[model samples]
Target: MTSGAITFGVKLPNLSPLASRDSILTTGTVAERLGFTAVWASDHVVFTPTTEHDHPDRRFPVGFDTPAVDPLVALAAVAGATERVELGTSVLVLANRNPVVVAKAWASLDLLAPGRVLAGIGTGWQENEFHALGAGDRFRRRGSATVEFIDILRTCWSDPSDGFTGEFCSFGPIHFAPRPAAGIPILLAGRSDRGLRRVASHGDGFHGTNLNPAAAGEAIARIEKYAAACGRATASRRYTTLCELDLRDRPVGPDEDHGGIHLVGTPEQVAERIRAFDAAGISHLALRVRALSGSTRKEISNRLSVRAGVEQLERFEAEVTPLIA
Candidate 1:
């Protein structure tokens, strides 16, 4: 990653070859053309039953009725459409899928995208989705399982001499072909204090705290403390955290507020806050352009339309990218 400007990426809502697919691809490509650093997709095996207001903390802006696209597939399509932009999952829940399968898919993506793949992974939150996929048992100890799963992936990618033996994932002497030409950057996401500790100990980096910047700063400190303790000072360079941005409606101002959760306001305010995060030690900020998890008023909803999505990309490029550059 370049050292000067911390990277900015947007999450594209791609559920299928739906009516919105072409628009998202075109809009995402436009974002690349306008100078956004990367594009990301969310992961969900299946939508769990819930009302928009059911889980008060849930943030899918369009609500449960909207389609949930496979992040890998959506990213692959986005990769085809754009050039010079990194692609990633805001987070792919590893508990629901075989880690080996994910390893292969992400590795292959790296092959095609070359140096432009970021592996953002999480343990998962929806137990019913796992049950629907016959992977419910994997959730019993997801925290532990996620660690082992990532270890297995590393083993498969790294030299076979670097082996692994864990309770959930164990393997020996398997040749996985076409190792990613450039190693994929793996980012781990979780909110627990223990989860932060785990990231410090075993992960390549840390991920988002949803909308909590204070907690993210604290988590960064925790990671640094543990990194220093474990003789992993070199690994400290890999820390990345996500920043939630809600730009639905507001004038640009440094004093702009997001209810203390996200960077709300115009592009400059968002970028300035992002710079603050960079100063605090965040390497990446995953931008969610649409309200993928909440409700919006009619006009704000209109701004989230495909056309306005392109405008936001342009605004960020013009107002935000230069500050970091």
Candidate 2:
């Protein structure tokens, strides 16, 4: 961990064709070598025509038409390729799969990476995805299902027998083995009220997106308030977030506000935003950088080639890492 700066991770283009074996291996190795604390793989099971998130920021994973790779499988390959960088799913939508099975997959990922897996998860927004996965019925109740889902994961990794009896799933006795030597950490992502409460109730951490210092602090306060109300211990809870990184040679004037969706500008300017996020209580910061700058907005792009994405990340390592470290 570098002092004076938050732990940093690069978001891999894992959801696209760029997640080819060669690309994953290269990206993971390069990020680890560049001193990144982790390399994250974003998840999606199937992309329908309705899959364009079209977030106002136009972030990566903008279109579902792109070739998609399974996040856990990609990261497992990355685990064999890199020695240290943490492998994360920058959220697997819990309602899209059976928790018992996905829990095993994540545990197996840990066997490969040891304590290096951050099982970043969330109750997904795309209700259609649940239908595609044949779990459509779980989407509406995904919130409560996810709470039980986390319970299932904990039992899978730490307990020998299954004894849960949730509305979505029920099991009496089963043998699950070769549990992870280091228990996997579940970091829940959400911005809604139910989402925040879910994190405070069951998550080892909170995973936020597109937030600035004030916004981050405000959310953390909410998580704390929720945790206190539930009598959940807050000391071990971690806070991490993903923000867009747009670095160009031109300087962003001091007056520009990116609305917290982006950390855009020259390396120096972006570094300042990074520092602010660090001060705002982000222990780990995941930057989703792209090869090109924007599909629609002045910033944000999902059209990333392996070569260009790697180059952009290398540039951040050379230019931004020093400013913060």
What does candidate 1's lDDT look like per residue over 120-152, in tens digits? 888887777778888888888888888888877
Per-residue C-alpha lDDT of model 2 across residues 267-301, encoded as one tens digit per residue: 88888888888877888888776552222244434
lDDT of 2 at 268: 87
Candidate 2 Cα deviation (angstroms), residue 22: 2.0
Work out the TM-score per prediction: 0.85, 0.92
Specify the highest-TM-score model's number: 2
- Output the lDDT of residue 262, model 1: 67
Residue pairs in collision within model 2: none
lDDT for 243 (candidate 2): 74
* lDDT top scorer: 2
lDDT of each: 0.69, 0.79
Worst 10 residues of 1 by lDDT: 293-302
How does residue 234 of candidate 1 score in lDDT?
A: 73
